[model samples]
Target: MPVLAGAEPFSHTASTEVGVLLCHGFTGSPASMRPWGRYLADLGHTVRCPRLPGHGTTWQECNRTRWTNWYDCVHTEFETLARSCESVFVFGLSMGGTLSLRLAQQLGDAVAGLALVNPSVLTLRKDARLLPVLGRVLPSVKGVGGDIAKPGVIEPAYARTPVRAAASLSRLWKLVREDLYKVTQPMLLMHSVVDHVVEPVNSRVIAEGVRSTQLTEVLLYDSYHVATLDNDAPLIFERSAEFVRSVRQVAA
Candidate 1:
């Protein structure tokens, strides 16, 4: 499957000692996060937003790939930045947040901090339990992107959700939840008040599971799931910068 034109990976090198690795959500392209990456870069912070494997392409292609492929992509990016920067912070949206949490668990103290928007950990939806069987019969379902409150904007993602790929994501959620206690890094959790895709309970579970003493939760009043591309995008960018600075101060 050919990748979408504007959905390619985005990267910016800065002179700062702190580096930020940005991860986009499942089925989403770097197009969804490039604005935030540019915002952080403008603030003189190095930024990398990698397009996950099998994304920005046909749902058929994405269905062939699993969570491991996506995880390896971001994990490699993190290792690359870790080698060059004094401190590396991770920021993600939705499933990207799940990958960030996995990295925090695996890297431990090396991960300076985390910033996530409308992250997904667990789903209360009963249908999710049937993914394995459903995936076998139905290759795809309806998509769960472009849930932004801002009009005239759309996230470049698959129109159909690949059931097999989503089942792999469910498996990842299980693993990440088990090691949530290992994620003690400072975290900024930004979630919308009303989201039709990911339930608000997901955020509650993360708050209760992680051991981060500096966990900060902010409610987005006017946005939905994709808060990074919604009306509160500016707030997400500005506060995220402040979060990086505050955590770097503590590390220094």
Candidate 2:
């Protein structure tokens, strides 16, 4: 499957010792995070937004990959940045946020801080439990993409949901939530008042589970699931940058 043009990975290097790793959601590509990555890069920070495995391609292709593959991609990027940058912060959307939390838990102080938007730690829908069984028979289902509330904005995402891959993601969610207390760094969470794909409770779970004393949650009244591309996008960008700076100052 040919990758979408705008969905390619994006990287920028600045002279700063501080770097940021931006992770996009499940079925989403770097296209979903390009604006936010560029905004931070323009501010002179080193940034890397990588296309995850099984993403930016046909839904059939995505079904072949699992959560470990996706996590490996971002984990490698984090390692590369950590070797050079004095401090590295991670920011992610949706499932990407779930991965960021896992990184924070695994690497501890190596991950200076985290900024997440509408992160999912668990599925609120009861049917999601059947994914492990149904995935074997049902290869794909209707996609949950393009849930943005903004008019005329389309997220570059798979048209179908690969049940097997989704089931793999559910496993990752369980592992992340179990060790949430280990992610005790400065944290900033942004969640929409009404999100269609990932429920608002997803954010609440992270807020309540993580032991970060520096946790901050911002409510987005105007945006939906993909707030990074919705009406409050600018606000998400600005506040995230500000949060990164404040965390850096404290570490210094």
Candidate 3:
């Protein structure tokens, strides 16, 4: 019998010279980041968006992996991008943004900047505690986004959430919040005021917590949770490109 290579091993991205490492949301694949990745790629950025462990596969596979595996996968991709490109930027969505935050904490001085779309950190509503403990158990959410109309990116392939895997995500956020002060890299945060999945407060909290002197925020006026493929996706790409350029100028 042969051993399976796992999720990250299955994720193969085309190599590029100057690129971005894009992390997708929880229970999401590279598809979630494809729009932004392609947008950057069109602007001459090499883009790398790899699927995390137990992702882009069956939900059972996802349930078997933890947050550590997911983090390691993204970190590996980041290293690959850095080695291949003259300069590298990091971008992420939802849970992916959480991973980006952790990366910034570790490599603030090295990271050119960050692009976070609809970032998810603390998502439970303020009144969520009213529900009973059992009633509050995280539900297994499947693919819920509407149509995705982008220039180059396609719809994500996987969506079923692994309840256990989601716990790992929460655990990772717990660790990342404590180190928020360590991230000083320039950041561009984009989110919708009407996002149904991740509350806007998540992005607000991150913007307030990061110690970076260079930080910018964009509110998606006509989108929901997945702003990358929503009405404002083009703006996402444009703003991200602009932010990266500004960061480069600052460094220069």
Q: Write the per-residue lDDT of candidate 1 for residues 122-203, one digit (tens) a residue.
A: 8989999999999999999999878988999989888999999999999999999999999999999999999988899989
lDDT of 2 at 91: 96
Candidate 2 local lDDT, 148-184, one digit each (tens): 9989999989889999999999999999999998989
In candidate 1, stretches whose alpha carbon ends up further than 4 angstroms from where it belongs are none
State each model's CA lDDT, in order: 0.92, 0.92, 0.74
Model 2 TM-score, 2 decimals: 0.98
Give the TM-scores of the predictions, in the order they appear: 0.98, 0.98, 0.83
Off by over 4 Å in 3: 1-17, 125-159
> Can you write out model 3's per-residue Cα lDDT over 24-134, one digit (the tens) per residue?
877666766665766776677777777787776676777778889988988888887787776788889888899999988987666778889987777575433332332
Best-to-worst order by lDDT is 1, 2, 3
Clashes of 2: 0
